[model samples]
Target: MIDHPPFALFIRGSKVDAFAVSDQLGFETGMEALAVSLFEDGPETMHVQALFETQAQAEACLDGLKFPSDMESFITQLPDEDWISKSQAGLPPVKAGRFWLYGTHDADNIPSNVPFPIEINAGLAFGTGHHGTTKGCLLIFDKLLESGFKPKRVLDLGCGAGVLAIAAAKALQQDILATDIDQDAVDVTLQNALANNVSEFVKSYQADGFDSPELKGQRFDLIFANILAKPLMGLAPDIAHALAPDGKVILSGILNEQAEMVSDAFTKKGLEVSPQPSLSGWTSLLGQKP
Candidate 1:
């Protein structure tokens, strides 16, 4: 496969707005693949990249586009190689607490004595354990497990790729309810769950945040919401109300600077935020309902 250089643009805005811009651009022809990612750290911003098969096509798209004042566009020409394979190879296996996350490419490397082994692949959704927020959540959950926290009912809100839900299933052997606003993400989660051999314990749904009928009058012993700071803040009340007494919540996908704001939102909703925070450009906070 021939590798063409990827062109990208930076936009200063929330992830929701960046996705809106991507959807608008998708309507126009010639744009093959558009990857838009929010900054891992604080200060909500987006890095949007457009992938093309040819240099001429990339230049044409870059030159013809009318960029907004807030958008900074650039083109990068990488060495000729199988970029997809190279990228996957670079991911390696990520270990957090007791959980070991590896892609199919790294399958043979996993030891038979591994604790909480999880298989994940880069697909339609996020959370392959490579992102800081995901790793942070895993570590927090491990700490909870170490402290003898036995959660019978669990919810993985915004269950991107269903990695958290899968981890819960593998570790606790309990059924999990997972949901995401995007159907593609839900699909990917299901696929990932099956790949991880936890499909029987993982139930996924596509619904707006905390608006699903399945969530009615339901409370969870533990809830994991690894979405962005804004959405996490908006879901604070729902999260607090859905938690079982003395239940814990793992919140990630936040910038270190935005951690206090998110923690305050949960705190105002009657949840006590844990001061121990993890960062990878992004931050993850652990909170519990008193």
Candidate 2:
């Protein structure tokens, strides 16, 4: 497990704005590790925390960013503790549609009737199924399964903790190709799949979106891309090209306001797009290839 940094730069604002800032910090600032979380007191409010090795580095990064008037930014010294594991241990089980997502602490508390129990702890990667985007994708996938949609080939692009990939493997009993741009995410995904007893069904690799030896000349019946709106839009053509005929793609990590833009990108790629229900100011889209 990666240790938490001693200092952090925090940005607090509306969920949409905070998420945008997070993307900028991750992509532009070249920050090593960043996390976005909802404020405990205000679900609508979100914060992006970027860790740093030193107090000066944290303050310097915070000073470099141009924050909106409504957004607040500051630097703080973090406690030298395994806060990631501690926070994860306190997280309650999340039931998204038919899937029950829980950390190791809740393993014994899993209900008997839960259709899919995914054990995901907060580690070096993301996607514990607590985020709205992950939950939205899971709910949509559950609905598709209920509608008798049986996909033979599945791909989980940006497969952070491999929650969606593991879910597909568990529900369909088929092999899943899970990819992530971050090597840490790939490693965590593999570990999570093994812990869930789906390691054999989940083939994970560190690859940029849809551009890897494993994905070459491959078509998937279902693809899950729970990434940000900009990346999703940029990847529309590639995503469409990689999808098999009549294949379905679940797209999330989009704010409600950005849904139409994301939908337009997929639509231009000749994929039929339908916006799923909004969850916690986020929107998920279902795209079908012709």
Candidate 3:
């Protein structure tokens, strides 16, 4: 009478993860869990399982399993190796034909154009055009361009892989500064900038969260940040501090349910929040400082 989603890690079950399991449990031997079989044996008595975030959590759940000693002989772990994938595994377009956004691996397929093709080689970082939240930001920013907001300067925060930064540079005629807490992401963004020929337009920096001394007293005509909800709330002061009066901002990477919370954070700092459509369940926000 329980629906337990086992906390599972994605390792080929019988291999390292099994070894890790035995080591973690202080057991002399380890056996991988065999897949459930629904055969003509008897009743389809199901084994209980649940997902735990860590090994400790998994062990705790294991402690609750009530496997009768008589039934233990029927269970066994199968080999974890798997190779049942289709040809479409690497076929690009995590979600197809939506204006070619380059988030995760986006730099590899940079968008092309006459004005300029802002190539961005994104890696394991978040906030490429592929993620729903990032794509939502791009859509709104496109509208900003359509509305004739000619920005001379732009700033992108939490610039994972600098995808948004590159897009703003190419879309708005260059002149961008992108920052991220992770140095690897910064490196990837610069590489993408160089690839897309927007190197001149984009600059990069590294900081913890958003309170770097390097960015103090700086303001921009356009600002973009696609970070998650909680940190974005904490960043209200810094965001407001960096945006120019009368400038506009495009914020994303928040769920629709939490949009109001993020909006309130900015509203208290004098940034006017307006609703942009949700991409998937995440919210995109637009605001202006007058």
Candidate 4:
């Protein structure tokens, strides 16, 4: 038997275009982990990194690529350390209103005062409740729950890691459609849901923003979308169409400067937008279909 060590691949470019490219690659590549971020101390530089199961896999994937002229690439052996566990261990538990989110590494550390505790481990996908956008969405979900809103039909669009969907399922004890454009994200969501013991309430699928036949005729009383600004604006009509009468929609992943544009798109679709508190420059909006 032979052991194959994993490899780490990275590319660097400007954040604006590089981030988008990195995101597309992340969705399509099925890497163990992929991330795009601005390089600290160098605001203009962006980094896109991916981890592959083997060096051969990484090289083969990169060989078939059409990287931009300015994009520089690097491949190296991934360290033997348990990076995932170590990374998850560093994230402190976060409280969003009544909900307390902690990774499995700190499961035993959950406070006694926290009423709703969600266990989310760091995985190949997003939404560990660390990102501002995710936190904002969680806060919106908490507020909705506190308001006595019981949505029997729920949809979590672009539900990376399925945190929002899991939260809704646990809170409402109802079926939830968790869809993501990436199949890997769908798998990760299912895994996370099972880990949180909410798998019975959550179902996942790979769909490009309501394109799946599974979602075509179905309407949801509550829809949660914690995706980017452009996609959120573009999907406004689809979201509105899929929403049941008097239904609620929670929108996050909009930068502070882009919130107005996103809000206007949904508002024009007959949704009355209610602003939620911003966290770390991200805005979360709650809307009601009238």
The model with the greatest lDDT is 2
Q: Sorted on lDDT, highest at the top, how do the candidates line up?
A: 2, 4, 1, 3
Please report, as a residue range, the 10-residue window in candidate 4 with the lowest summed lDDT: 34-43
**Higher TM-score: candidate 1 or 2?**
2
Query: Rank by TM-score, descending?
Result: 2, 4, 1, 3
Candidate whose TM-score is highest: 2
TM-score of each: 0.80, 0.85, 0.64, 0.85
The residue-by-residue lDDT of candidate 3 on 53-103, one tens digit each, is 345544543553433333322212223323111111222443322245433
Tell me which of candidates 1 and 2 scores higher on lDDT: 2
lDDT of each: 0.76, 0.84, 0.59, 0.79
Q: Name the lDDT of candidate 2.
A: 0.84
- Quick one: how many clashes does candidate 2 have? 0
C-alpha lDDT (0 to 100) for residue 78 of candidate 4: 60
Off by over 4 Å in 1: 1-71, 74-80
- lDDT minimum window of 10 residues, candidate 3: 33-42
Q: How accurate is candidate 4 locally (lDDT)?
A: 0.79
Query: Tens digits of per-residue lDDT for model 1 on 1-290?
Result: 44354544434444445533443343233354433233432445555445555666666766655546565556665556665666567577998888999987899999777788899865436677877789999999999999999999999998878899999999999799998877766888899889888899999998775667978789999999988788789999999999999999999877777789999999999999974565545678889998
**lDDT at position 219, candidate 3:** 80
Q: Judge candidate 3 at residue 75 and give its lDDT.
A: 18
| Two-way lDDT contest, 1 vs 3, winner | 1
| Global fold similarity of model 1 (TM-score) | 0.80
